[model samples]
Target chain A: AQTVTQSQPEMSVQEAETVTLSCTYDTSESNYYLFWYKQPPSRQMILVIRQEAYKQQNATENRFSVNFQKAAKSFSLKISDSQLGDTAMYFCALRTRRSGSARQLTFGSGTQLTVLP
Target chain B: SAVISQKPSRDICQRGTSLTIQCQVDSQVTMMFWYRQQPGQSLTLIATANQGSEATYESGFVIDKFPISRPNLTFSTLTVSNMSPEDSSIYLCSVALGGTSTDTQYFGPGTRLTVL
Candidate 1:
């Protein structure tokens, strides 16, 4: 069994500033994937960024990036140059592809982010 | 990235009734999944709809409760049977466009079901 934890229940960031959302997971599997998903007010789940456990380098997608520390079992998301549109509920998810097991995602409770102007 | 749409974006139904939500993807996908997001909670995978086979459900979920239909690679439906207030949640449909195990998945807008 795997579990993802987002310690922060809510976060706020001023416009044009940067914000970091923390995430940690527990998994025995060596090969896995970590993802950050954003659900806006419209209720649309959007993929923010993803990190492969095997990759030592962090994953960056424009303003969204991940600080993945495999040894510490930590994967945090950083949103740079934050805008009002970045306000959303962010969730961290983990997925492992172990043999004979279905590919499913285990998500954290989520952190509601508010970008204040 | 694939375009996924779910019909009946939001619905308010009475308890004991049922609601069937349809998911359609613009392109054929390798895998389709259903998830539930309760209020103020994160997403929990309900089942994986496999084409030409029975849908595989996760722990605490059953076929009778969430009957899923995956007729093809691009279309699927999930019916909430004998709904209750506890069933009030956002149901999302997602798809994996690639065959790799680590491929990214695209999500639909989600169908909001309110059981009153």
Candidate 2:
């Protein structure tokens, strides 16, 4: 079984600043995928960024990037130029492929982020 | 990315009742999944709806409690049977278009179910 952990339950960032959310996972699989999802008050889950375990380079999507340390089993999300719209609950998820089973997503508890103006 | 929509965006149901939530995708997808997010918690996958076959449930979930129907590649429904106050959570539907290991999933606006 794979488990994702987000140690921070709540985080706050000033507008136009940068913030980093930490995430760690435990998995025996050599190949897997890591993802960060954002859920606003609307309850809409949106994919923020994703990183492939095999890739040595981190994944970056505009202002959102990840510091992926495969050896350390750490995948952290960084949001730059944070805006009020970035205020949401962020969750870290892990997806692995099993030999003869369906691929499933395992998620962390979540970190509530508040972008203060 | 695919557009997904869920019916009855929210509903307040009495205990012992059932609520069926519909999920529709704008484009055909290879896989559809159902998830539950308990209040103040993260998302937990309930089942994977396979077209033309029975849905595969996760551990702690069963067909009797969450009956799922996947009639085609773009439509599916999940029914919460014999609801209880513990079932008061947000139900979400997600779709994976490529059906590959690296394919990203797109989610629908969740259905908020309140059981009293």
Candidate 3:
């Protein structure tokens, strides 16, 4: 069984500042995927970024990036020049592909991020 | 990304009642999943809805308690049978963004359930 963990329960960042949310997971499988999803006040789950385990390079979106260290089993999300809209609950997730598998996504407890102006 | 929609965005139900939430996707998707989000918590996969076949439930969940149906490629439903206070949570329907899999899971707006 794979377990994803988010250490920080709550985080705050000043407007235009940067903040990094930490995430770590335990999985025996080699080929898989990691992701960060954001849930805003609207309660809609939105995809922030995704990283393939096989890729050595990190994944970067417009305002979000991840520091993925597979050996350390760590995948962290970095928000650059944070905006008020970036205030949301961020969740780290793992996707596994088993033999004769129906790939499923598993999630970790979220970190509530508050962007203060 | 597929556009997924879930019906009965929210509802208050009696403890012994059953409520079925519907999910529809704008485009055909081979795989769909149902999840539960307890208040102030992370999401948990409830089951995998496979088109034209039975749904595969995860541990700690079952078909009798939360029956699911996937009649087609773009639609699925989850019914919370004999609801309890513990059943109160936001139910979400998700689908893979791609046909070949390994794509990010796209979520619906979510259906909030409250049992009295």
Residue A40 CA error for candidate 1 (Å)? Answer: 0.6
* lDDT (10s digit) by residue, model 3, range A1-117: 789999999999999999999999999899888999999978889999999999999999988999999999999999999999999999999987542343787798999999999
Error of 3 at B111 (Å): 0.5
**Each candidate's TM vs. the true structure?**
0.97, 0.97, 0.96
**Per-residue accuracy of model 2 over A76-106 as CA lDDT, tens digit each:** 9999999999999999998885523436888
Candidate order by decreasing lDDT: 2, 1, 3
Q: For candidate 2, lDDT tens digit of each residue in B2-96?
A: 88999999999999999999999999886889999999989989999879988989889999999999999999999999999999999999997
**Which is the better candidate, 2 or 3, if ranked by lDDT?**
2
What does the i-RMS of model 1 come to?
Answer: 1.6
Give the number of the best model, judged by DockQ. Answer: 1
C-alpha lDDT score of every prediction, in listed order: 0.92, 0.93, 0.91
Q: What does candidate 1 score on TM?
A: 0.97
What is the per-residue lDDT of model 1 for residues B88-113, given as tens digits with 9 covering 90 to 100? 99999999755567667789999999
Q: What lDDT is reached at residue B76 by model 3?
A: 93
Runs of candidate 3 exceeding 4 Å displacement: A98-102, B99-101
Evaluation by TM-score, superior candidate among 1 and 3:
1
